[model samples]
Target: MRAFIFPGQGSQKVGMGTDLAAASTHARELFEEVDDALGQRLFQLMREGPADELMLTENAQPAIMALSMAVLRVLEKEGGVKLADVAGCVAGHSLGEYSALCSAEAIPLAETARLLKLRGQAMQRAVPVGEGAMAALLGADVAKAEDLAEAAEADGEICTVANDNDPGQVVISGHKAAIERAVAMVKDDKDRWGIKRGVPLPVSAPFHCPLMRPAAEEMEKALTETVIVAPSAPLYANVTAEAVSDPALIRSLLVDQVTGRVRWRESVLAMHADGADHFVEIGGKVVGPMVGRIVADAEVMSVQGMDDIEALIKSI
Candidate 1:
């Protein structure tokens, strides 16, 4: 069995979908549709960037989703492949969940684009700049990360584990002071926590922590107005790390995920345990290497451009 995965933020870059759009009419059309939905020349910004504008949360979220969907569109239309035919399950990292839902047909592309734009804006607005921060813990697992977070949560600060990415990496997010405290603690005694080092992330806001309650509330309201159907393939939700096909549950989970830990490591393990030996990463290659580390022997492929889509078609 095979699982289809989508990458999250930090995977986007300038000229992300340029090659795919040039190679396939389907990809170009999908980019056009997303641009039309967002009412901006986003594809142009992506193809030719000043770098800073495209890095904005509002732009990057939808831009990443658009590129991922473009790759999927090329695979379906040009390669004559259907996602439901090959992937038994689908999953994504952080914002990539929206891409997974869109690919699974649970959400329409236009609606997905609009929702992501709102999500990005809301998350950015949730915290003031410099008041929040995030950090990556190298050579640490969930337990050690949680302990470090607990140790750093002094003076009622809100430090907590944001993402359980893999066996060797975990990310934490919270108030800037608390995150700094966590990093200091790691530097002071890395061996005690079984971690190598703590590196601060260059993110706009501290995401996936209690500090994002306002963002979660915003998502709850937005998701309530949006319509979602059951996905054709089961999705291993980022918050739950379990396969869920119920539209109502998926909606609730998506909101919770705003301030909840992204259980990516557990989600991958669960998919592998469920007989998904092959993992196909759509759009970006970031998540594929993490999957490789999580399950070393599993077959992993990341589809990005025309050649990748064609290779995937032949493999399937």
Candidate 2:
């Protein structure tokens, strides 16, 4: 069985979808439609970037989704592969969930783009810059990362594990000072913590933690008003790390994901356990490496440009 996955934030670049748009009319049309839906020349920004602007949370979220969708559209149009017929399941990392849903036709492309823009804006607005921060813990599992966070967070500061990415990687999000303290603790107490390093992430806000409750509330309202249908294939939710197909359940999970840990490691393990032999990364290569760590024996492929897509079609 083949499983398609989409990448989340931090996977975007200046010219990510340009090659796909150039190679496929379907991809170009999808980019144009997303630009129209957002009422901004997002494609232009994506094509030519100063790097700083494209990296902004408000811009990066939808930009990542747009590239993923554009790639998916090209695959569908050129490869003669439809989601319902070939996919055993679908999943995405963080905002990539919207892309997965769009691939499964659970949500329209325009709605998916608009929702991501709003989600990014709300998440950015939830915390002031430099006040909240996120950090990556290398050579540490979720349990050790949690202990490090607990030991570091003092004076009522909030710090929690945000993403359980893979076996040796975990990310923590919380107050900037708390994050710094966590880094110090992990670095200072090597024997006790068993953490090789704690690297701070460049982000506007501390995401997927309790600090994002305001963002979660905003997403709840937006999702409630948006139209959602049952997906063609099961989507492995970030919060649950399991396959879910019900529209209402998906809505609830999306809202919760704002302040919940992204259990990507377990999600990949679950898909691999269910006999998904090949895992195709649709948008970015960020999650592709993590999938490799989770299911080393499974055939993992990252599809980016025309060559990669064509090769994927031939391989499948």
Candidate 3:
């Protein structure tokens, strides 16, 4: 069995899909469609970036999703691979979930792009700049990270584990002070917590925490108006870490995902438990390594450009 997983934020680049768009007409058309939907030449921005504007949450969110979908379309149209037939279940990291839903036809491509644009804008505006922050808890598991997060909270400041990515990797998000406190606690008590170091993340705002309630509310309004259908492939939700086929549940979980932990490790384990032996990381190569760490015995592959698509096809 095979599982298809998509990547989230932090995987974007200045010229993400330029090669693919140049190589495949399908890929180019998809990019054109997205640009038309958003009423902006996003592809141009993606291909030639000043870095700052493309790095904006609003831009990165939709841009990454568009590139991922472009890669998937290339695989389907040029490589003769069908995601709905090959992937038993699908999962994604944070924003990657939107890509998965779009690839599976659960959500319209244009709607997904627009929703992510709103989501990115909302998340960016949720907390004032310098007021919130995020950090990566290296050499720490979820339980240990949670304990460190609780110990790091200062004066009721919000600090919590955001992404349980792999065995020794976890991310935390919250108030800037609390994040600093968490890193300090881990630095001072590394032996007790088994934390190597808490490295601060270069992010616009603290995401996947209570501080993002405003973003969640904004998503609630946007998702309510958008049409969603059941995905052809079951999606292992980031909030629940379980496969869900119900469209209503997927929508609710997406709303919750704005302020919920990305249970990636558990979701990968669940897919493995269901007899998935091959894991395909679509959109970006970042999540592919984490999946390999989660299920050591499973075959892992990442599909990004034309070479990656050919390799993935050959591997299967």
Candidate 4:
């Protein structure tokens, strides 16, 4: 069986979705719809330069979702590969959860765009710039990373694991001082902590930690008012690392996900255990490699543009 996955924030770049928009009318229409929903020329920002603006959390979240949806639209319309027919389940990393739901038809495309825009803004607002930070702990498992975070925490300064990306990589997020202390601990005692290195992330906010409670509250309010339907395929949610289909449960999980650990490693393993041997990543190439790293023999492919879409159609 196959699982369709979506990429998250960091996968975006300056020229994303441009070729798909040019080659497929479905892609073009999807981009146009997203632009109209957010009332901004997001596609132009994605295609043109000015990296700083495109990198903003408000822009990157929806822009990444739009690119993923553009790829899915092309695959459905031009390639005749419906997600419901081909994918046994769906999953996404962080912001990609919205993209996954859009592909599964639980959320409308335009609404997904708008929600992501709001989600990004709320998350950015939850923490002030230069006060929060995240760091990547290389060569460390969740246990080691947690221990490192505990060592770094003190006097109400919060430090906690944000993303358990893989066996070798874990990300932590919290106050800038706590995160800096964690990095320093990893550097000062690499052998003691069993960590090779710690690299601070270039993110605007400390995401997926207790510090994001305010953002979670914001998401809860928005999602409560939004209309959601059951998805065609079950989603392995980031916070739960388990398959969920009920719309209300999905809604609650999404709100919690803002301030919870992204259990990506466990989610991939759970998908593999559930008979999804092949994983297809739509629109971005980042998650495919992570899947390979998680499951040593899992077949993985990433679809980015017309050529990749056509190739995937043939392969499927």
Candidate 5:
């Protein structure tokens, strides 16, 4: 009846998990463990940011996971809530999937932190700066976005829809030229298709398209070398938008997700169909609202700190 979800990359902020670490010993332990695993004080960067360093893909990945896991630990240890008992299923957007897996016990918290750090670094290094970009097409569905992308890919450049986020929000990523072309096309034809907005995202590289195949290959090798276990709760994979329990399948899906469209909209629908009435977003508030838009009748909550966690515990 309840589904716990985790947020991805863009949800991170400078001082995200500080309050949680201050309020709960369990949360503090989670942060300490992540620091030990990564051999660096990621928590320090998260608490006191130089802004630029924390924003780097490599640091952002594990930092976000550390915050989410800290919150999860507080909820379970202090709030007296068991993950297996309260949640029917779990899901997350892109990098959030790693957080969800950690929450489900498919991977240890330390390993999740390390793997996410590697994943972020690989993804960041996959494309050069200014050469690749991503944009959001608001009020446009996947079909229209695809048409626009196809129309804009004629200049020896690659452009493709990357994230099918929700009904009216789709994100495209590829070469900067192709993305610019696609944005122009969308803006030119905005009134014809009821598209009211087209906005470019602030990202260092294009992600989740065929352009990220190198990152996928890198992840494949990294994943094979890492240990993955059957999750305590089913994980709704980003590629399939379906619950996957088998470890091998999860590994394959993680590799595939790099070059595959993140079916976030479909994943929410599938979870709704599977009888999830409540959706709790960990780490940030972005996905909770998106889930609300996808499933209008479902109850949604986002937890960011000790007060929010306490409020959630009381509400649940």
Candidate 6:
């Protein structure tokens, strides 16, 4: 069985999809539609970057989705790979969930782009600059990270484990002071727990923690205005780590995911348990290696461009 996964933020860079757009008319149409929907030239920024403007959450969110969907379209139209026929299940990381839903036909591409734009704006506005922060605790298990978060919270700081990425890799997000405290705790426990140094992330807000509650509330309102249907394939929600198809449930999960932990490790385990033997990462190569670590027996493929797509076609 095969599962298609979409990448989240931090996988984006300048000139991400310019070649794909130029290589195929289908890819070009996808970019044109996204531009029309958002009423801006997002593709231009993606192709030729001042870098800073393109890196903003608001732009990166929709831009990544557009590029991924464009690549998917090229594969479908030129390679004869139908979504329903080739994919058994679909999942995504953070904002990439919106892209997965769009790919699965649960939501249209235009609506997906619009919703992500709003989501990115709301998340960015939830906290001020340099107020909240996120840090990655490398070589630390979930239990140890949670304990560190609790210890940090005892000091009246708001810190919590945000992402259970994989075994020995967890990310904590909250107030900067709390994150600093948690990092200190992790370092202190390094010798005893066999943990390495924690790496701080460069993000505007403390995402996937209580600090994002305001963003969640904003998303609840925005989600209500948008229409989401049952996905063609089950979506492994980041919050639940389980397959969910109900539109109402998906809506609630999307809102909750703002301030909730991203259970990526558990989600991958669940997919593996459900008979997924192949994992195809679309748009970015970042998640592919992570999936390999999480599910060592599974065949993981990262499809980035035409050559990668052709390689994937040959492999399958």
Per-residue error (Å), model 3, residue 206: 0.5
How many steric clashes between backbone atoms does each model show?
Answer: 0, 0, 0, 0, 0, 0
Model 2 steric clash pairs: none
Regions more than 4 Å wrong, model 5: none
lDDT of 4 by residue, 202-241 (tens): 9999999998999999999999998999999999999999
lDDT of 6 by residue, 149-229 (tens): 777875566889999999868999999988887778767877754569788898988999988988999999999988999
Write out the backbone clash pairs for model 3: none
Q: Model 4's lDDT to the true fold?
A: 0.94
Q: What is the lDDT of residue 84 in candidate 6?
A: 71
Against the unseen true structure, what C-alpha lDDT does each candidate score? 0.94, 0.92, 0.93, 0.94, 0.90, 0.89
User: Which residue ranges in model 3 land beyond 4 Å of their true spot?
Assistant: none
Q: Please provide TM-scores, in order, for all candidate models, with all chains considered together.
A: 0.99, 0.98, 0.98, 0.99, 0.97, 0.97
- The alpha-carbon lDDT assigned to residue 176 of candidate 4 equals 97
Which pairs clash in the backbone of model 1? none
Which residue pairs show backbone clashes in model 6?
A: none
Prediction 3 global C-alpha lDDT = 0.93
Tell me the tens digit of each residue's lDDT in model 1 across 204-271: 99999999999999999999999999999999999989999999999999999999999999999999
How far is 252's C-alpha from truth in model 1 (Å)?
Answer: 0.4
Please write out the lDDT profile of model 3 over residues 22-67, one tens digit for every residue: 9999999999999999998999999999689999999999999999
**Residue-by-residue lDDT tens digits, candidate 2, 159-271:** 99999999999999999999999998888888899999999998889999999999999999999999999999899999999999999999999999999999999999999
The runs of at least 3 residues in candidate 6 whose Cα sits more than 4 Å from the true structure, single-residue gaps closed, are none
lDDT tens readout by residue for model 5, 1-316: 8999998888878887887878888988989999999999899999999888998899998998898888888888989987877888999899999999999999998889989989988998898888999999999889988888887897578889899999989999999999998788767878765666779998998999888888999999999998999988899999999999999999999999988999999999999999999999988999999998899999999998888888889987
Off by over 4 Å in 2: none
What is the TM-score of candidate 4?
Answer: 0.99
